[model samples]
Each structure stands twice: as C-alpha cells, then as structure tokens.
Target: RTLTGHESVQPQTSREMLSSGHWLIPTIGGDVWLERPPPPMWWIGIVYTVTGVKASDSIARLAAVLAALPIILLTVGIAKRLFGKGVAVMAGLILATMHEFYSYAINPEADIFLCLIVTAVLALFVSMEFPHVRTTGAVAGSGKPSFFGTRPWPMAGFFLLLGATNWAKGLLFGTVMAAAPIVLYLLGRALQERSFHPLRPYLWCWGWLIAGAAALAWPVAVIGQYPEILQLWQEHYLGRLHRGYLREPWWYYAVQVPYVLLPWTLPALVGLLCSARAAWQHAGRERFICCWALSAPLLLSLADGKHHHYLLHCLGGWAILAAVGLAPLWGWLQDKLRLIPYSAALGAVAMALLAGTGGILWYSRIPGRWGTIVGAVVFISLATWVILTACQQHHLLRAFVGILAPILAAYWLWVPYQASYLDDYKEDLVFLRGAESLIPNDVPVLVQYDWTAPLETFWVLYHMRRPGVLIRDPWQAAEKTANGGQNSSTAYVLARRLDLPLYRRAGTVETVLESTRTRGEKNPDQRRVLYRIHFTQPLPPAPEDYLRVVRRTLW
Candidate 1:
C-alpha cells in the first residue's frame, strides 16, 4: 500500500481500481448526482472490511468471485439430480474452465454477480417445480405438476435479488424482465393442469420480494433530494439506453461467443445436440433448462442494442446442459473400461495437441522466458491429467474435470498476458497519471469532448483524497484563472486529437500517459476516450465556426 503522494494502497491493476473508484466515492465538484445511492452492494464493502484484503485487488473483485460460487453449486445440484454426482461435478468444471466465465468472475464487474443471482433463481424455481420428496429420479409432481413443490422460498427471494441486480445495472434488469415472466407463466400453466395451487404462492412470494427489495434499495438521496437522483438516473442509465451510443452490430454477441466461452462451448454445444426429449418429457424443469440454454442466446442475438457482457447469464444454462449432455457418456463409462480404446485414441490426439501447442509457444519468440515455460508446462500437465482421469473408472465428473483442467490451466497462464487487448481504455489512464504528477493541484482539468468515465474515476479517486480544483469545461476553467490576482492561474486542457491549435495561442497543452490493465489481454490498438493535458493558459476562443454555439460548454 505505497503511495507516491497521498496515503493510498496499490491493488492488483491499480489503474483499473482507480477507474472504478467513482462507484464508491463522490469528488467531482457541483455535480448533481444523489449524495450516494443506497449502495445495493454494500456487502462488497463489508467483505473488504472483514477480510482486511479490501485494500487488495482481490477485495475489489470479491463480489464477482462470490457470485460465481452459486453457479458451481447449482450445476452440481442439477447434474446430480438429472444425471449423477459425476455429471454434476463435470458440469461445474466445464463452466469454471470457460475463459469468459473465469474472466468475469475474476474481475470487479457486476456480470458475474448477475450470473450467480440468475442461476439461483433458476435453480430454486426449478427445484420448486420438482421437489426432493420424490427421490426416484422422477420429476417430482410430474403427474401432480405443481410449481410450488417443496421449496418455494429460494424462488421467492431470488425475485427480490433479481430486482436489486437491476438497481445495480440496468442491463441485468432487462434480462430478468425478458426471461423470467415467460418461464413463470409456462410453469403456472403446468401447475394449473395438475390441479395444484402453485401460481398463488409463486406470485405472492415473488411479488412481495420485488416490492420489499425495492423499498430496501430505494436511494436515501432520492427521498431527501428527488430531482437530483432522477436527473442522474436519466443521464446515466436511461439516457444511455435511449441514445445507444455504444451500439454494436446485432451479431456482436454471437461473434464474441466463441472467444468469450472458449473450450466450454464445444462440449456445451454437443450437449444441446444430444439432449433427449424422452428423458426430459413430462419433466417441466428439464424443459425449462433446455429453454434457458437456447432462448437467452437467441434473445440476446435479436437485441437491437447489445454489448458483449449481456450474455453472462447464458453461460450457466450451458454448463448445466453440458453436464446433462455428458451424463450418457459418463453412464456408459461407469459400466466398463470398454471405452478405453476409444478414449486412448482421443488421448493420443489430445497429446498431439499438447505437443503442438508447446512447440508453437517455443517458436513464437515470446518475451519473458519464465511465463512461456510456465504456459507450456501447464498445457502438457493438463492434457496428461485429463487422459489419466479418463482412463480411470469413468466418472463423468472426472471425465469433464480431466478434459477441462488443462484448458483452465492454460487460460490461467495465457489471459494475463493477453490483457493488452483493452488498450483502447488504457492509453487515457496512462496519460492522466503522467499528467497528475506534473500538473499543479490548483489546475482545472478541462475534460475533452467525451466523458471518459474510466479516466474521470481515476482522477477523482486519487484527487478526492487530496481535495483540489478540477474543473471540466474550457470556459468555466478560464474563469477560475480570470481572477488571478486573488488566486493562482490554473492549468486548463486541450485535445491533441482534435488539433484545434488553440493550445498554441493559450500557451501549452502537455500530454500525459494513462494506461489501465485490461483483463488477460495484451496492449491493444484502440483509441482512448480522454487524453490528459496541462494547459499553461486559458484555451483560446474556439474557432469562429464552433465558439458561437458554445454557450453551455462549462456545465
């Protein structure tokens, strides 16, 4: 926890932590956001407090890790029930092996938590439809067909949490809205056919949870200052949705699926192909699982405005399906080692893969000898581990684990170096940090054309701990320097990319370096949003073409 100036702790990817700092604190002056939205995620803060690792990068990312734990548990539960414990373990491993899931679960982003909560809701609701009272591998209440089987509470609470997740991120709320109602309604029809009163309990519990969670989460600032909160929500969440400035082609999620999901997609897709209507017939829960795996991706694909992260929830459904899909293979193995010859053939193929992968690394002329060697070691070790486990009395669980272990290990080694992929956002962070050291505390930071929230979060987190004037607009920034008799003239800003040449008249606009860590990616070629600058004097009036209409640039 060393700080160059302010007493600050350095966490894993110090720059990324700083980028996210805005979520925790308020430092931007005169901004009208609510003082603090009742932190729906205060538990994250609690985790840091209890573990004393809050100051560490791990603490910042704890929420994601915690969220992923449930998916693992539920996969096991579903696998054990639908197939066997062996399949259940295999399913969980397949999920953990996916680079996308691991990346999200290892970061501070809210997607992993979204994944966890959504998984919980699905598991609980499915369990309620098929209670444990019937342990004979039959979907409980198939003949009776009740939604409210034995456990309704889990489903009830998840609805509340689902809403709370919306409060955390608007996209997740949208996911729930799109998916949950249809699922519930279909389950309700099944319950009706079985002559059971399931819908009432389902509605009562879920309805109360949603309302109660909202009341608990209603921003205190909104109660005390309504206008400010509304405006903030409008500008921040709803406005962004309306504007859709970050819009991507409809196929973006579909395109990213292979890279994001990696090794798991192969097996999971195979699982979907193998799913049996005969096995799942009359099984409402199994039907829902199938629906979940396929529908979420289709919905995301159809979305007009989409982002890569929206599909986090879809991965869990895949894991469970893959587990179920692998169940048959696992079952066949349990009876005999008769499949050994076939598996050994596959093992030989996998060995060739391992050797070829090692050779590629050795020849790539990669920097860092240790990391490269470590990667090669991981690849071979995992392939061998999988082959050995496969050769054992077949545990579908072990089979999946055997295959997945190496992939996960390879990922554990590769992704960190690949983090340069987020170079788009990193350039600005680097520029800001370099500027921070040279620029005086009194200098007003005139932000460029865009709101580089990531860069803004960094400066705010660092500068808030040491209060100073950091203005955003050129006009307002000039005013701070206008009264130079009483106060020292503050440095303003200009963009190198905009190339207005205003800085030449004003004096100087020095460049700063800003680089943030991108998860498991190498430095990328993308442009950063904000470029840090230190102006020696007020920005000259905008060119005649633009200055006339710049009435409210200061705000």
Candidate 2:
C-alpha cells in the first residue's frame, strides 16, 4: 500500500507513477518511460482502464502485487513435484513469510512480477522429461502433459512468460532467466542419457517459444507506436550492461544477497549446501532448482549496473533450496520429538522480543513507542506459543515456528516503524496540499536536479496536476523562468541545499517552502528548499552551462 498510501507519490513510488502515466497517455504523442521496456507500465494502465479507478501509484502497485501471488503458488508446485509435499509446504511458507518478498510486494515495481514470470518458467522447465535420444518427440506413455507434441504445456508457458518478462524489463534479463535453466537442463539430460540427441525436445520447445513470443501484443504495439524505441533501448537500457548510469563493480549483486534476502540468507545457504549433491547427480528435480536459482544472479552479476530488485527473480531458487535445507530438520524433529526443550525455545523467543523491543525504543524518536512495544510483545508471545504447540504436535510446522517469530517481527514491528521514520516527503505533501492556491496552475514547475529521482518529479506534478520538467541545473531553470515582456512564464524550481547558493546568486529568489529528509544508510540528513523564482528580470546564463550542453549535444 506504500505506493498508493500517499495522496502525493513517495520517492520510488513516483518513478512507478511516471512510467505508468506515460502508458495511459495516447501512444501517438505520448512520452514513454525509456529506462526499461513498457510492458509492466502498459499492463498497469490496462488495469486502470478496465477498473475505471483513477490511475494512481497505489493502483499500479496493487496490480503488480496481485500478479506476484502466482510466484508462491508456482514455487509450491515446482517444489512438490521435485522434492515432496512436505518440502513444498516448507518452501511455500518460507517464501510467504520472507522479508524480501514482502518488501517487493509493497513496492510498485516490476521485480516481483518478473519473479513471478521467472518462477513460472522454472516450474515448467522442471516438469519436463529428458527421455533417451531415440524417443525425443514421440513418447506414448510418457505421463507428461504435452501441449504441442514436442514438450509439456508448462514449457510453452515458460516461453510466453519469458516474452512478457522481456517486455517488462529488457531482453537480457528475460533471455538469461529463461535460457540458462533450459540449457542446464538439456546438458544434464544429455549427460544422464549418455547421448546428445536427448536435446531435441528442447529444440522443438524453442520453436514454440518463438511462436508464443510473436503472438504477444506488446512487441507489435511497441514497435508500431515508438519507432525510435530501439535507439532509446540501446542508449538507455542496453548501454547500462557495459558502461552507463548507475554503474557498479562486478561484486555489487554478490554483496547485496545478504541484505536483499535477510533473515533467510543463512537458511538459504544451508539449504544450498544440503542439496548440492542431489543437484549434481542427475537431470532430476533437485538439479533443476539449483541451476535455476544460481544461474540468474551469476549472469546478472556480469552486468555493470546492479540494483537490488534485479535479484528478486532468483527468489524461487533461493526459497526452494532453503526448504531443502530445512526438510531434514523437520523429518528429524518428527522422528525424535523428545530431543528438544520447549523451555529453551521459549527463552530464545523472549530474548528476541526484548532485543527487538529495546532496539526500537532506544533508536526510535517518533511517537507511538508504547503501541510498537505492545505489538512486538504480543506477536512474539503468539510466535512462542506456536513454537510450543508445533513441538508438541511433532509436525513440519515446528520448522517454521523457529524462524517465524523474527520474520513476523520484521513484518509487524520494524517495517511499520521504518515506513514512519522514512516518511521524508510527508511534510512536503501536506504543505503542497495546504498552499495549493498560492501556486498558479499556468506557472510551469521545474525541478533542478543533476540525477534522476522520480520521487521529486512525481510529487510536484502530482500535487500540481500540471506540466513539469526535470532539468540538469539551476542555470537552465533560471533561463526557462525568464520573461522578456513578449513571452513570459513564471517557473517554480525545487533544489537541494547544495544548489541553493547558486539560485540565491542568480535571482531574487522568494522561498516557497523548505523540507528536510532524515538521515539513513548511505545518506545524510538532506535539506531541500523550493523557490518561487520569477524571471521578471532574468539573470545572464552561465558560460559553463552553455559548454556543458554543447558537449552533451556533440557526444
């Protein structure tokens, strides 16, 4: 709900709205969100159109979250098919309770949806049979659900979803996420059958995949609507693979694994260790899950631009492996219920409660401390009871009971508090709403920023519900605000503290509003001031601004 919670869009939520808004506009003259492909945004726009609800950040994000439900179901199906009913249950529960999954669910981005599609692809890939070389296509009693007399319908589904995934993000992500597992499965099949001819089914599957991809409307619509899209894709998206904006070291995704998959990272690693042997043995279920999980991130790490959301596609593999690791423990507990002490388990839960409560109280300065503590205590107490009950029952549930407390605590306790603390734009939204009358609708608003932060653009345009532009520097804005009697347009410029001195030196800047964003990881407390800088008398443009623009145009 974070995406839709604010009347004005929040930081990352703004980016979502901007892209989706472009989709809603008519394709003829509409602007496109060029950072990536437009499938996610276009789909969201379709949702808004069908529902007749005002297309807002919340609605767009809700669409993605709803689409994400299948990721869990598909994971369960794949796990049940590969491992067993017990492993499937544990895998589903782990995925359902995961912090990474929950965080992305609320985030109005394509990552979760991509995860869903990728998981579906893996599920289908895992369901196929690698028969001996002689019987590649015409197997009578194979017991597999064949769609095209080539491979199972799930294989076809993989190709269709891969097409959608590509449209949502880009070709590279879709290709790697889909192709790696298929290649690995084929290799494993060939190794197992002792013949290269076993790969014939996969070759036929590729033809089906190509046909399914061609049938998708996104490809036709995108090419028909935006002819220059190829150029934009190259300059904006593909360029990032080698050297473009948001470049990071090769080890970037490697470092992010712990943070992105927090609270589950340890279990996931343990799961990988436990399943390694089975995965290496044959082209069976275990091997498929392992290859599916490891391949995407390894391939993604090769790219120069790394973001946290890209790793979400691997959630299926990670969750299944973790379940593999936890499955033996569950079996052991079931077999020997008398080995563990409930008293010790309860004590650990109590310590966790105290640590959680004490940390929030010590660090949180916001109101509602009492409510947060009470909530934590109650949740922890409930979790402790669950552990005790599961221990008594001697079931697979006890496996979840151990980790459920902390995971739920993060969901119930820390996330709400973090959201409250991280509301850096709350005051600005309120202020904008209150003083809406002071700002005229006709006066164009321009945000002066060196980097792209769609949050500012979203809030300003959303609050004003008017035309706005994000330009590189204050000087560009200063020139835009100039009124030479014949052509006059007053511009509102929002700038951070570092850029404030430049605005001050440039014109008679009247302060509109000032807001401060709290400090957090990798960022200091930042102050931003908005100015109603009218160029009734425009200042001379800086010479460096001209040179910069010339260099950019030339480049």
Candidate 3:
C-alpha cells in the first residue's frame, strides 16, 4: 500500500544490483560479484521492458508467484505419475498450504524461481520409468527407475531444468538437484536388485553431453565476457560455502523444519517414515521422492551457509510425502467416525466441555490436588468429545477441516497480531514517507541502527524519493556530512532510542520525529524506536567517539 504497483521494492540481494543498475553482470558496492546469476534480474528486466514500467514490489514478486504455478503443476504431475490422481491432488493441496513454500512465493527473490527449476528437475526424474517399464505410461513406473538409462527426452528435460536452476540462483541447489536423481536411482536399484548395473553406453553419452553442456552454458558466456567475475565467483563460493558466512548450527534446519512445515509436519513425518519402510521393503517411487527430499538438506547441513529459503526446493518432496498420508488418514477417519453420528448435540457438548476446560484453566483456584484433577478431567473430556464430533461426518471435506483446523485458526487469529511486529517495515516506510515534508530531499538521511531492514531502505530510496543511507555510527555520519555541502547542517538521522544518547553526546541533534516499534520476539524491554534526529554540527574530537571513526576506516 505504501508504494504503487509499478514501483518495486527489492531485497538486499537485489538492492545492490538495482542501485548500480547492473543486470547482465552482478555486482556489489560497484565491484564485480557473480555469487548469483543474472537470470532473475534479467527476467525482471524483461517485465520492465515489455510493460514499459518501472520496478515495483508487485512486479518483482509477480515473477516469484508466476514461478510457483509451474512448480505446483509439476508437483501434481510427478505425484500423479508415481502414486495416482488422488495423491496428486493431495500433493498440490499440501504444497499450496505449506507456510514456508508460500512465504517465498511472495518474496521478490530468485529463491522461489530456483525452487521451481529444481522441482521441475525432480519431476522429470520421476517421469522416466525403469527399463522394465520403458513403454509404460505415467502411472506404470516399474519400481526401479535407472538414472542412466532413462528415456532421452526426460533426461534432456532434467538437465535443462538443472541448468535453469543454476542460472536462476547459484550452483549450490543445482549441483544437489543434478546429483540427487542419479544417486537415488543407483541406490534404489542396489536396494532392490542387490547389484549395480554398468551405465548404458547410449544413455551415458547423452547424459555426459547434457551434463557438460548445461553445466557450462551460462558460465562460459559470462566468464568469456568478463573473466574478473570468475575470481569473484570462486572467492564467494570458497568464502561463503567453505569458510562460512551465514552459518548456523548443523541442527538449525532440524529445529526449523517443524515450524516451516507447520500442520503438514506430522503428516510429512509419517509419510517419510512410510517411504523409508517402503524403500527398505522394495525400492520404488517412494524411495526416489524420499531421496530427493533429503538430498539438499543433507548437503546444506554439511555446508557452512544456511538459509531457510535454501530448503524451498526440497519442500515439494515433503508435500508429496505428506499427500501420501492424507488419503489413508481420511479413509481411516471415515471408517472410525461413520458410526459416531455427527450431530449438533455432539458438537455443542464438545464446545461446552472445551469452554469449561478453558474456564478451569483460567480461574480454577482449587489450591493443588483439586485443581489438578479438574484440569485433567476437563482437558481429557474436551479432547475426546471434539475428536469424536469432528470425525462423525466421515466425509473428506470434514476430515480435511479437522486436520487443518488448528493451522487455519492460527493463520486467521495469530497472524494479524504477529504481523504487527513482524512486518514493521510497512509502518516504518509509511513513517518515512510522512516525514518527507519535514526532511529535505537533498540532504542524506542516515539510518543509524544495529539491525537494518532492506525493505525499509528500498522504501526510503524508491518510495520516499530521498537520499537514504545506512551508517553504523551517528558520529561518523556527522563527521562526513558536517560542512560537506549546502545541506550539511541539516542532515536527518534515524536511530533507535538507545542510540540517541550516543548521537547527542557526539553532536548537536534535533528530534524531528519519534515512534516506538516492537523490537522482535526477543528484547521485550527494548524497542525499535525511530528517532528522526537532525544533526547540526560535527562531533568534537573525543575518545568515546573514536570507535565511530575507527569503523569508517573500511570506507
């Protein structure tokens, strides 16, 4: 709402490129950087070119949302090819509802696009049936898909998608996608046949050609034009992947998976275990899906850099697995609750019991023993009644509602409240826009805070149309801007409330605007206070402000 649909706000990854107006060759701070490919930027650039419109969050995010469509279709097709139509629909539904997948579906980045490409690769991998069923249709895969001898077209398609994924983001996920299918096919074959077969000659030639061509296509073109970018690529890969940049604990995703998958976590877990069991018994499509799902995470866990979106490509596996359980669970629910009778009386009784449980939990002051008894009785009765009543209908729709009720409730209830703090960027952007009249457009607006939001910076520069810059220190800002130009005496500074004292100690400052915002989940006592202070002069030479000067040494 803050910016028009035509104007897009980019994430930090895209911010540097957007600011530098560099699309063909990626750069950071005006230097050549090829950590990410130019495919996404090129795509966005095409949107701008065709529409004759400027960048906006709407257009940038539209790319991601558009990428999601093919992913969903590919997922359904893959699931249908392997499991059948029912599982396909369930897989689509599971993916559509997943919080993590949908989150990136709206993000203005290449992550979701990469996810789409990787998923397409996996779908193609699943499409090519085993040699025993080479002439079979989608639903007739012979439980033993050989990666080496897959149909020529599907193998070509797999390589194409893998290449697209590499160009869409980086090679991290692309490498994983390319290797995963081959490894899974080999492993699945070994598990089922108890022997390894030699690579078929015709298939091996085509595979090698596709692999070599797809892997080198973009890099050859890029490096041929700009050889310096290759060094940046090597440094980035070595530093970030090997040395560690955004490294988290090895178990980071282990903890995050529960939150990421949300309501589907339990079902996915059940399905994963089932797939494992099925793989153990006889390696088949389930084993392939299981392998695809686990590959990226296992590789990523071994790597130093970790981000949640990196797991987006793997979510399709989780969704398909989760979908595998939905039909069986629904069937069991129908069979179990068919005789229970879904009546209004039963629902009312359940609701009343739940209400009583809530009341007891809230106000039951029965000291110790009586309170425990009351709590247990109320809780148990409520649980039993609700389960019975929910299952009474025995229909798929009712079962779905029962299964997803908590998640739906949380989305409808808790999300608005959580978003109040989580999406503080909107308010901050609006605040900056409102203060536009008070602050001069020409004077640089220094955002001095420890934690910064890239969206806010995008909003400030693009939406607010002001000279927005972020500095680590207010004193350093004062030092640089002081007597630097005509508007030097009136530059604006947005700092947290805690940092305001530091600014005051360093120089003369005037508060133009101030507002309090929730800091985050942690730091309840602290807040993200936006203090729009106007620095009048440079700071005096002093020891306390020496740290600020020292920080500027990098500049």
Best by lDDT: 3
Check candidate 3 and list the clashing pairs.
Answer: 7-56, 8-55, 8-56, 8-57, 9-57
lDDT of 3 by residue, 238-276 (tens): 766778788788998887766778668877887887778
Tens digit of per-residue lDDT, candidate 2, span 1-555: 233222233222333454445442122111233344555655565666666654465666577667677888888887787667777877887787767787777665556656766677666655555222212222212344334556555655656665665655555566567668768766776777786565655555565657456434555566675565566667755666887567888788778876766667776887888878877765566676777777767877787777776777777778888887765655654456456566546655776678576757664663566675666567666665555455455455555766565566667767567668555556656655544545566655565642334344444554444445555555666555553222343567765555665666556678777654411213422455567765535466567855475223100
Q: Best TM-score goes to which candidate?
A: 2
TM-score, model 2 to reference: 0.75
- Tens-digit per-residue lDDT, 484-536, candidate 1: 33344444342333333443444444445333432122343222223333345
Model 2, position 109: C-alpha lDDT score = 59
Any runs in candidate 3 off by more than 4 Å, and if so which?
1-21, 25-35, 44-61, 130-154, 190-259, 297-310, 338-422, 442-490, 493-511, 518-555
Worst 10 residues of 2 by lDDT: 24-33
Clashes of each: 21, 1, 5
Looking at model 3, report the run of 10 residues with the lowest lDDT sum: 132-141
Task: Supply the global lDDT for candidate 2.
Answer: 0.59
Instruction: Give the total clashing residue pairs for model 2.
Output: 1
lDDT (Cα) of model 1: 0.51
Candidates' lDDT values, in order?
0.51, 0.59, 0.61
Per-prediction CA RMSD (Å): 7.3, 6.0, 7.6
Give candidate 1's error at residue 442 in angstroms. Answer: 7.3
